[model samples]
Target: MKAFLPPTSYEYVTVHKVQGDDVREASDVLAAEEPLEIRVGYGPVGQREHRTISITMRTPGHDFELVAGFLLTEGIIRSRADLQGVLYCPDVQKEEERENVVRAELSPAAALDLPRLERHFYTSSSCGVCGKTSIEAVHAAGCPRLPPGGVRVPASVIHQLPERQRAAQELFEQTGGLHAAALFSPTGELRLLREDVGRHNALDKAIGAALFQDLLPLHEAVLLVSGRASFELVQKAAVAGIPVMAAVGAPSSLAVSAARNFGLTLCGFVRQQRFNIYCHEWRIS
Candidate 1:
């Protein structure tokens, strides 16, 4: 069908014709960026040789933090102690096309819990404990009980995030489309923001940034997304131990369920002057 066109293909329509109808033209071209692979290593030299733990296509920056956060969210390294240092794959940094990945070097004693991690091939982005061989494994990992008292933000405060998030988007304004995830303090300060053509990748970048800063288990924080909340996103928040998630759009049914299941507060459809409390209403005043 004509409508099912590739991103690079642009079509034309007459928007304002001198004689007949007007024409408009547009295309689905997405910004192209590098995809990175994260590897786990345990050798005397650290990251000299290792096996790939996960592969994700990402925007071309923050490669080290991405490796750190990916390993963390995947439950590979619980704390920084398990990791030695993050480095570029020797060949990747040397090559122009393959420079997007970083290897997270682990201590020789460090490793993924084999019998526990082998339940299934980890899905593309379900970073929460939901994708384990058994739900019991999550409990075993000491996922940690989140504090029930969470950060509270007024609806008025929530309403301003969409516009604020957009205003900081340097790359998206040019591309006309991309996703962003930003961390905001309880009092509405913009802590950090990361953007990517993919919503998941954007979130990964944001999480990666936070991980690099030694900010894991964001129990006292709030996460705001440029778009709707999805199952994968809720899972991401869960792994990070973030207490609340707010989106400028709606939440998927699965995402809402995951939030409730994990005791994370979820808010959605936030714009201008209103927002929806998808899971916990108590978190919003």
Candidate 2:
């Protein structure tokens, strides 16, 4: 069955077209970005409560997954078992507002430490804090260093992932304005792909899907990003236990450092049948 499309993922916008020296007014397809409020609800059924965890500007599809992935990577919720259920706020009076709010109800036994969450809880679509304090917080999260000898990929397989990811990007084909993150198995099978205007959101959606499918600790997989790798991307991948990350663009110095410190295989400039491995070269044969 053909699934229904969420209207918030894309929209038609009037834009000025420019070609060489000529310009014309036309309607263009654009990837949508909107704010989503993520809340955490916990406590016994009779005494449940909610707290707004974050408000992020994101491309709105797979929003539930986005919330889940964000919570997991942020160290707010550790595992699938910590989550009771996720839902759009049903009591919201406005339909638009309803879609913009997501509540993740944690298990009754779960304990949330507000102090821990307060350190680096806020982030925007374009930038994630890489301050010394934020880095310390990431260290406090206790994401284990990626173990050695988990997954290895052939150079041929690694080289082909970008093209495969590009082929699966249906939205980008139409809008030409979205970033993507893809998951590939050790054998180079494209497991999943997600798109968003923000690279981090796309990555979150992809990780959230894997988590929903009980695919955490994806040590046998490689993550491919359509854009440059930043510290936030590497950090998120580390949280998901993803051992390898490849990008069609460059890797920031911090990204390279994070990948190296966490023992993840990092690849960049993955084009023209060539790529640079910034760290953990043993993962690629």
Candidate 3:
């Protein structure tokens, strides 16, 4: 998986003189692929059997957190108790995909309104807006307000992030295709970073990493995206209890609205030593 997901930064390649002749090889970076499935189940009574709800194409790592994050953001599941376990599925059909994708099975007690998911998504990854069609739907998502306590982040801290984030991106620098997500403490020490070709995948990887490390209920940390923050990113961060969401690029209008609705601290255009805090300014120390 590490081979699939390299550091976000690029490396300098030194070409030998080769008797003054030019080299003929190209550095082609590969895209990462993995399996992610969402499942549900009943409690520890009776068969307590689980059921398969959804399966998604994804990169190979962070299978569990991706499940948890996906369920929370999709409004299917909430809290630690809502989940039984999100692990690699031994489902035999998985071999059919180009690569073996993992699945997350939930307890039988958990019910997923598939129509809710189906109505919003026509194709995978193409439909970024499902379950969030109307403003009323947004209201139903239940993040109507973000962190009640004032959280503040400093502009100086944001100005220095792009460089620091770049320093850790070994793969993106080499491949020129991956997006990155880095988690930093309030004081600004980077805790974890994940990179992938998809902006959403990058975030999924970061959240997955955090979950793998037992870093849940992440109210105290700040999440930084290498690119612009999107509505899905805001939704994911909000559900994960991430109070601050920052981006190196511009955020969509929906993202701003979602941030405000969820009481999330949304910041964008985080370069040139300047940034804009679109919502929850109190947290920008």
Q: TM-score of each candidate?
A: 0.79, 0.91, 0.77
Better of 1 and 2 by TM-score: 2
Answer with 1 or 2, whichever has the higher lDDT. 2
User: What does candidate 1's lDDT look like per residue over 186-259, in tens digits?
Assistant: 77778778776678777776787777778887876778998889877777677788887899889977677767
The Cα RMSD in angstroms, rounded to one decimal, for candidate 2 relative to the true structure is 2.6
Q: Summarize candidate 3's per-residue lDDT along 95-193 as a digit string, tens digits.
A: 554224345545556665667666653223355655345434645655445548855667677777788788887676666777888888877778878
lDDT at residue 28 of model 3 (Cα atoms)? 53
Cα RMSD of all models vs. native, in order, equals: 6.9, 2.6, 5.0
Clashing pairs in 2: none
Q: At residue 47, what lDDT does model 1 achieve?
A: 42
Candidate 3: list runs displaced more than 4 Å.
1-23, 34-55, 94-99, 108-111, 120-135, 142-144
**Rank list by TM-score:** 2, 1, 3
**Backbone clash tally for model 2?**
0
Give lDDT tens digits, candidate 2, residues 180-267: 9999998888898888888988999889988999999898889999999998899899999999999999998888888888899999
lDDT of 3 at 144: 47
